[model samples]
Target: MCVISGTHGVEGFCGSGAQIALLEDAAVIAAVEKYGVAVMFYHALNPYGFSYCARTNEDNIDLNRNFRDFSRPLPVNAAYREVHDFMVPSTWPPTPENEARIGAYLSTRGEAALQAAVSGGQCDCADGLFYGGAAPAWSNGVFRDMLRRHAASRRRFAWIDFHTGLGPYGHAEKIHSGPNDAAMIARARAWYGIDVTSFHDGSSTSAVLTGVNYEAPLEECPGVECTGIALEYGTLSLLETLQALRGDAWLRNHPDADAKTRAAIKRRCRDAFYCDADDWKAMVYDQARDACLQAITQLAAAPVPH
Candidate 1:
């Protein structure tokens, strides 16, 4: 079993904290070991983004979107293209006119459409939102390598990657990421309960994403039966989260901004992805522990392959 947190840089702190909390819990560690599950924790996959409070890596690439088969044609986001200029204007906070233009697009296209356009991983417009890089990113290579080294020998593997910013406050959405076959879906439901969702069916709070990190195992360890889920916990409203993302993009573009602006942007980003309440943290830990335990139990029950 493997758990990954902080795959998106700034959006990862809550996940990172949850990972640490799980490791420190004696009961969780004992339970995992008793099930004969080897648990691997990947904290802060994009260290540069984690440290700088930025969503992208040092190359301004969205680490989550950077995992793609570069040999093929990259995915396109025509909807994002329509609003690209408005989303990241030259000015910080955007001028009133630019903001109005964005508001108009959102009003016209509706929220889901806007989300698909902006958040659905774009290969074009590297300077724009959710840009998937032209080549595999550093984190992409590292993650693939980690899977090859640690997961190749395992007959059955289960991964729970932690994320935030796309659901009701403190609610954890278990999103399955591998084959959408009935058996696979049933297995996920049996392990994580019926609350599990799939992007293929548009049941997830998240739009259908490309180049997601969970695909790494399928490429690196083809023989293993890999079942992966992204436990996306929510903190802020969808619109608020998008605003924070745009604010961070603006900050990235304008690095020479004043301290006040930077601090405010960072605070918004944090609040958008993390709820700084004791109850919220408790929910994160509870859900993470439950998911990990469930995965381990399921993996232990499965027959080991020769």
Candidate 2:
């Protein structure tokens, strides 16, 4: 079982915390020993994002959306292109007209359509939100190397990649992380329970994303029975989180901005993904432990490979 943190950089606070908590968790420790479950806690998949409190890497690549075969034709998101100008406007705080354009789009297309358009992993927009890079990132290659070195030997592998800035505050949405494979989704639901939701079927808060980090395991650990989810913990409302992301993008584009503006945008970016409250951390740790335990149990129960 792989418990990955920092797929989104700033969101690593909660995910890294949960990893520490799980490491010290008596039940988890006991289960690992009893079942011989190899729990690999990989931290800070995107160190640059984690350090800078930004969602994307230094290259503005969303690392979560950066894991794909770049040789194939990438998915074009014309919708993201349509909204790009307003989404990251000329100003720090978007003008009323810019927001009005977004509001108008939301009103006409509905929230789901807007989300799918905006966050469905756009390859065309290097400067836009959720931009999957035109080529494999250095981190992507390193991650695959880790999988081949440590995880390829396992017959049954389960992964939980932690994320933030979506859904109700403090709720951990277990989003099916692999491809739209029925058998894989069933295994996830069976291991993690019915709460496991899939974007492929519109059952998840996330859009139908491509180039997700989970794809790494499928490619790297070929033929392994893998089950995974992006445990997206909600920190703030979607709109607020989005505004934070915009502020981040704007900051990245404008290094000459004032110190106060820079600080405020960084704070906004961190706050959007990481709630510092004790109660919220407690909730996150609890859900994370539960998810890890579930995977451990399933991994233990599976028959040993011949």
Candidate 3:
């Protein structure tokens, strides 16, 4: 029921499907009521991120990375440590020094290594954006409560969290859930069809990470057989997206940066994630709607597996 969009601010384009067409699909609605399926659509999990055109929430926490128990031991993203400085630069966009450093790192480590290092969430840096919070965020609490309320009576659950900025442009990558139960995998393929890929198999476009929006429900609703999918649409190159994030993060941390510079950075970040063209928007909306309807129908109509 969590239609996750706006994990990155510019990715709001992906939210159009969940908010509008998917909710309107007649087949989806019929399937839901006909099979007694209850739903709770938590759209735009990171509203501040959506509005501000940044990936993280208002507290500078990546909503996806903020779900764990922050009071005790916080999970460390070791790879993130390697690229943290580059991600949240102390100065503005690509200073000559930074450009040289980043160029060197890319040359030595290669593109995927740079991506995996910087894109992964980090802790211990509250000032830098995308810092996973020390504890459960307000959104996390709301989601958990909602899951408990809506799913307590159900014996099965399915989730499709929408995303953008990976893989081929306009293609929707159906990323499999993290848990590896046989029945869960079967249910996902049936719902999303056979195109879905699991992280365990190394076929998925999504990188392996911890503390996602999906993992919470699985842990909380032990009674219900829960499965999750990330409907990842593509908008730009991964390098471009990462660069946008870098610039945006730099602007956020350095308040002394001029307004013009800040505005330019924001624009780049938004453009990198969202397509402003009318045709592009229309296409994204249509695909998202189709995906949602298919998910709703499959989840609602399918009989529980024994």
Q: Record all residue pairs in model 3 with backbone atoms less than 3 Å apart, i.e. clashing.
A: 70-134
Report the lDDT tens digits of candidate 3 across residue range 1-306: 456666555676567445676677787677778766666677677788888888777777887777666667786777777667766677775778877877899899898777666555677778664577777877788778878887756777777677778888777788886566677777788877888887666677766655677777877787776778887778889888878888887877776888899899989988887777776666776766666666667666676756
Candidates in order have lDDT scores of 0.86, 0.89, 0.73
Candidate 1 vs 2: which has more lDDT: 2
Q: In model 1, which regions exceed 4 Å deviation?
A: none
If both were scored by TM-score, which would come out higher, candidate 2 or candidate 3? 2
Query: How far off is residue 296 in model 1, in Å?
Result: 1.0
After best superposition, candidate 2 residue 15: deviation in angstroms?
Answer: 0.3
State which candidate has the highest TM-score. 2
Q: Model 2, poorest ten-residue lDDT window?
A: 297-306
lDDT of 2 by residue, 197-270 (tens): 99999999998888888888999898788889888998888878888988988889889999999999999999
**Error at 190, model 2, angstroms:** 0.9
Worst 10 residues of 3 by lDDT: 1-10
Give the per-residue lDDT digits (tens) of candidate 1, residues 1-306: 888888888768888888889889998888887987899999889888788877788888887788778999887788788888888788877799988987898788888988888889898887778888999998999998999899988899888888888998898999997755677887788888998999888889889888888678888897898888989999888888888888888888788999999999998887888888999999999999898888888999976666
How does each model score on TM-score? 0.96, 0.97, 0.90
Residue 129 CA displacement from its true place in model 3, Å? 5.7
